[model samples]
Target: MDLDALVARRRLGWERLRVLSRQRHLDGAQADELLDGYQRVATDLSTVRSAAPDPSLVTHLSGLLAGARLRSAGTRTFSWDMVGRFFVEDFPAALYRLRWWWILTALANVVVGLALGVWLYHHPVVENTLLSSVEVQQLVQTDFESYYSEHAASSFATLVWINNAWVAAQCIVFGVLGLPVIYVLWQNISNVAVIGSLMHQHGRADVFWGMLSPHGLLELTAIFVAAGVGLRLFWSWVAPGPRTRLSSLAHEGRTAAGVSLGLVVVLLISGLIEAFVTPSPLPTWARVGIGVLALLLFLVYVFTLGRSAVRRGITGDVDESLEAHVAPTAG
Candidate 1:
């Protein structure tokens, strides 16, 4: 129990831990060694604090123990480098892997919205049931368009971003339930279809298309991506393939979370357009063209850059160190 003896016995282990703590990366064996050393050093610090109470010795051991604890616990530091990697690699690769899911979701929602719009245009009664004569007229002539310009551009952008982000987040967070994803999609599409049908029946299809296209293209796409991720989570539980159901769900869940975060930026761009470009006095073609351009850029990022990332073995999931970390199996 002599403090000098104790220090002599443990000082080498503590020094090794200090060395390992400063490393940028640790091989598995080194990581294990760090953990063991961390525990021993922690005990040494406690013993020295109680038995010796030497300020300098306690301070040195405390600092070394703290660093070792961080190294052993895998502390993450936020950095511009990590941010760059996420956008350049993680986000796009996640989108690429889930491209089919989102693409299918986008296509199906668009088709349903169009079909419903067409059906409602033909069925005046249905449109009337949804909106009375006064409501319909107001919606077509003023309310629909005024809604975009009623607020300051910046405020409107923030408002739209928050609302849309909430929707997207809900789709991902509630995706495990399965039916919620379907219900969310249905609610979104139904609202658009109702509005579109009413506008078309009122002979203001031009207004509807013009106002909607300036932001709807990208906005709707982001929503579809959220829905796709959510549905995939649900399906992961239903069919995990080679992975255990929990493993499949967890992997998809992490990727889904990444997609959710990335879509926030995507939705912000769309919101800005809806607030600024959609309502500005720019020519209809110009406004729609801006929206189209934004959508095209997103598509290219997901498909083009994403494909390359995927081919490079990136799937927007956590790195192998954090994954199951298993060695490859023989087929």
Candidate 2:
């Protein structure tokens, strides 16, 4: 009604609005509440005074509304580096904590081999372990040519690749949990011991070269790399340097896990070639060549490739993300 009362109301309104308006962006609820409050106040002011509303105040309010709209427009965008930071910070640390399983597994690795070896040494007639009757039957009944002919050559090859990868993945992943690591070591020990005993008995030490030379190089190296990681895990807890067992396991497990997964992938690739290709009835020279190729693949992955991948991942958020995702996939 009075000029003084009118100005005071306008001043109070502007003051509160200013407090909320300071932000560059306004949320929907806040902006709506503010706009409604100002609209009512403006109506009252227009009645009390002939003067128009201040343009500067209006511009400030408008700017906040515009900024809020801008914020909403780009809602779907996200930082690519987010996942990189997670794997680098979270997954590796998880692997580190899991190292103890690796450590325990390494110790038990030799048990199966020795058991198989000793048994084969005494029982000259036994050609392989018949621990499971079903396994023996499956091996005996398997008709390679019939199975191979049933699927298209390429289809069979692809299927074998996938199966090998799955098996390798299972071995490497479960090994970290310690179950596969023990089982693998047991299998290897039993199997290798038999081979050793057979070689010794038959005095055909060189036969190992022919029987194992081809895909064996890659397959065996992959197993060892996995075992090495397992051993590293064991040593972490056993020695633990100065730290507690848990603390040691946490740190080493991380380093060991990347290596373990890499090993699995390597084994998968090797197994695929051995199963689906490698000429099935590979000659001695071809087997040796494949074995050499497997050795080279192992060397490249362990020393040059795996190191670089992990390094790029941990170096920075961006590089690690790229390395973790794009590089391994492309390779």
lDDT of each: 0.88, 0.52
TM-score of each: 0.79, 0.46
State model 2's lDDT: 0.52
How many pairs collide in each candidate, listed in order?
0, 13
User: Please, what are the lDDT tens digits per residue for candidate 2 over residues 1-102?
Assistant: 365565565666656555555555678887775666555544543443344344554444344444333333334345768545444443343333433443
Q: Candidate 1: worst 10 consecutive residues by lDDT?
A: 322-331
Q: Which ten residues in a row have the lowest lDDT in candidate 2?
A: 322-331
TM-score of 1: 0.79
List runs of model 1 lying over 4 Å from the truth. 1-73, 324-331
**lDDT at residue 314 of model 2 (Cα atoms):** 43
Model 1 per-residue lDDT at 190: 93
